[model samples]
Target: MSRLEVYDLEHNYVTTLANAYNVGYSKEENQLWDASFQLPYDDPQLKYCRPLRFIKIYDNEDEYIGEFRIWPSEKKKSMSDRQVKIELLDCLHTLTDSVLFGYYQLNNYKTDYVFNWLLNKQKNKRWIPGRVDFQRGFSYAWENENGLVDALFSIPKPFDEDWIMERDTTVYPWKISLVKPQTEVTARIIEGYNLKEFTVKESPQKLVNRVYALGDGEGVNQLTFKTINNGKAYVEDTFSQEEYGLIEYIWTDRRFKDKASQKASTEGMLRNWKKLQYTWEITALDLMKLANRPSNLAINQGREIKANELRLGKVIELITEDNEPIQFRILKESKSDIDDGKANIQLTLGNVIGNTGTTIADVERQQEINTNYANGATNIVPYIFDREADFSNPVEFKFFVDDDVRNVNTCELTVDTSHFRATSKGNTSSPQTVSSSTSSAGGASVQSATSSAGGASVQSATSSAGGSSTQTSSANGSHRHRMFSPGDLIGPLPETRYVAYGGGFVATGSPNDIYTAEAADNHTHTVNIPAHTHNVSINIPAHTHSVSINIPAHTHQVSITIPGHTHEIIYGIFEYANLPSKLKIEVDGNIVPIDSTSFERFDVVPYLSKDEDGKATRGRHTIKITPSDLARIEVQLILRVFIQSQLGGEF
Candidate 1:
């Protein structure tokens, strides 16, 4: 037989009230236990008792079974019988009312560390406990507001790491441990004697072979743990081409932000599924023959054996009637009233192999062991080609142009000169000279008259004869050079030249000026004319004369001669069968605007010439992205080389 004992939260013993019927308590997984008992209205102890008082259950041997706290309630009467229904809650119930407040931050801290910190924090705030045990640790970061329990559970456990919470029997305190599965079963039913009811269920629908994990990346918001290389997905062909069927399971765990960590987690999940593809559920009830034996026991020799070791998180192997063994982990346990201190023990078991979950370390090791390329698959081959290559073929290419390449359409040349010449002259001519001559006939008439007078007088004949002998005389015409001396007035000065006193022409003299000659005109010339008939001959001939001329200082006309030269350049044209409507560009890892002056879409000969190469190299217009955005961007290039091909596409 078992009885209930009452005590205050301070551990002080209290008197037991009468009529303690309906005294059983119920405990649920991860929840508080509630127990109820009835007390007679006439009991005086009820007046002093209050809620929050503790209650303990003891067997006939006075061994403690469990304990709970009193729940506040009002007294009531039923069927003319007055009784006080007192509610009691287990120790875990105390935590439900303790609200966590303020900000808390955990960086790379283990779950156990946080649990201990929470316990200490609550203990400082008047929440007392007998003992506490937490042995598991999880690595993660927690920030912001959350409840104590919420924050504790937020720390994710790797697939392989297992943790459980249960009250220690030896001490009245909570115990959390990284428990393992037991090798043997603590209880069983043989010959179906003590077995009251049993049910078995197998679920194959829950089988899954693939898992995908998602989380927040370092800078990006969302990231997935899918096999990818160079921004493209690398699907596992073998898994998709499975012999049986495809069963993919996608799991989103935002706790992991690192790629390696996310990969490990997904791998762990897949490993877990591969270990146990389906789940088996078994529900059983057992009845005991011996009253003193523990509720948990194994069947043997037709007599019930006590197996007090059975507990949550423990593994058990059951032998069926046909001697087939089935392994299960105890998931749930419950006790129900039958009659007079006897109880029915119900158990729920699941087909979960012990220690089968995958660990992060194990996942990481597996990833290292697996080759990057899938089985029987080759790596991608890159093609490189010049920009002028024929891309008519359907293959992609990495086309590039050199910086020296020029697009003639976008170039201009200019030339300028400073001097030139044309034709002009200034001349001086001499004035014509006029000459006159007079001739005379003479004494020939006197000779003829002398002969007639000869006889008149002999004495006069001598004089007459002399007179008759008088001869006719003539003067010769002569020419003399006109000389210019000092004090000579050279009238009507030429427009650009003047004669000086020394008989030399000057270019700096004033034009059309009259000047007086100096008194130094010492040289003279005479011209004479005779009265004789003379024959005259004149000669005039065309000829050129060499003369010294002076010119004024002036500039020559401007003339320009632009040499014929060419602007050499190379251009690149990019084409894609399916190019993105929009694109982003970065130069030397620096993001630049995608406007007309910088980068833009183009068709036809999309000229990547000297103008475009001014800012970057053109060997291979390599598109580079940060490690974080590798998964976000997907672009591929294919190369083809040809002699001379027209570019006709848009990028």
Candidate 2:
């Protein structure tokens, strides 16, 4: 089982929570570690727990999960006999509580500059921001954003790298810095194994085959694709239209100021949104502790991965429905209860670790693989198919190799002559010799021969073969002059001519101070802006409040109705001291009593489970806080409700 250690607002170790119930935590909007726990009555260490308390949770292996802090009004205690609940937010929440003022721009700044900038803007006077003596080489630019935390997180990474938040509460001013997320260690989340219930949601509800892409300006001046798309402001996918009809959408991206960019983004959106897609909502078991592994399963090398290695943002393998392994990053994780001493974890897998093939399915498997591979599949680790060796004489094969992330097409191999010479190896033959086209009557095997030319006689000697020697002479003595030259005689060099030096247009002065673009006619110049995206937000001024629920302990059950909308909760623990031998406390119709022990006090922790969907239905649920009157017990039940407007939701 995991344990929670609490500390004073100053971070001085106070007490180790001996008991808690309805314990759960999740990663959401901020991706910060905010945990919830319940106690029957507030523990003396946290009698009126509000905020500013430090807490840390660890598993059975004593490995750190995360560090958290209790902000103002985070604690709820049932006055003596009632239920008490407390929650702690990550120490990194300090930035979220702070906001930046005025417009600020940094051209080429490091991570330290961001940290110090945030430290200076933070309004939390109670805790001094930590110092950053080091910085990352990556430079990021920021224009304006009141949310300093989100602004810092929005920093662009150099490559496919990621930025992460860290904190060290060991010192007075917590040591914090922005560093790259580490994925050095990872565990496998496979089907029929550690992976449990999961939902593969594939829907085409948002499919749009036609898009009216809009950018920049407003109304009449809005940049569009007309100039680039044959005088058309909208783009469409003919193939998608043929299948899904003409589902249209208006894609507005203010980042693009020109028609070409807007048009490009519009076409891209059309292509992407033209088809159905799948989203995975998976629930994986967090069996991080070695003891949690089931001894029955025969785990093999590389398969028996320790669950402890499953950290947020770390890439891990998840076996898909086809039993094919897929690596995806963990975007969100929530732990509700300890099932058989193992935490029940629900995870939202995001970003494929490797190429998951471009297309999800096709009429055929190989065709699907080929098509997706052609489109763009990544990190396949060099593989080939349909290339058999020594099969056909002239074989055709297809292979894939990493070349600037492009896939080359099929290639053929063969040796060719006018007609088929050799069909197989070792079938070649040599050619015979033949006579030349020009030959004299002195043939082969002729030992001697004689010839006469120009009134001269020639004799030939032989050695049992034809070998001739001939001589001829002719006198045609008509010879001419060998060489001659005419020196300096090109009409006397055209009679030297010269004109007086007339200095044409010479000046040494600066160009006119006022200048404008000169063009043949009136035309619009393309205004270029770097390719980027804009984030939309609604400013909801920051605020805080407190919840006080005081109900006395009774023998019967009392109920509290948690509204249906976006509502979830964490119930704390109930501790009773010096209870009589027969005294007991009742919770939700069940009695939770400590095992018989010599200790004078009993720390009672209820085992509460969340609905499979990780929510409470819209209705009244019993929160039984009954203790035997004769026994005289004090129960602290902590309830932390995460409410989103009229609807309640998970924390």
TM-scores for all predictions: 0.45, 0.41
Tens-digit lDDT track of model 1 for 482-576: 34422245544445544454565544334333333333323433434433333444444444334444454443443444444444443443232
**TM-score for candidate 1:** 0.45
Q: Give the distance in Å from residue 172's predicted Cα in candidate 1 to where it truly belongs.
A: 6.0
User: Which candidate leads the pack in TM-score?
Assistant: 1
Alpha-carbon error at 344 in model 2, in Å?
Answer: 2.1
- For candidate 1, give the lDDT of residue 82: 88
Candidate 2 per-residue C-alpha lDDT over 259-335 given as tens digits, one digit per residue, 9 for 90 to 100: 54355445545555787655678877665644647533323454554444555666777776685776666766777
Single out the weakest 10-residue window by summed lDDT for candidate 2. 413-422
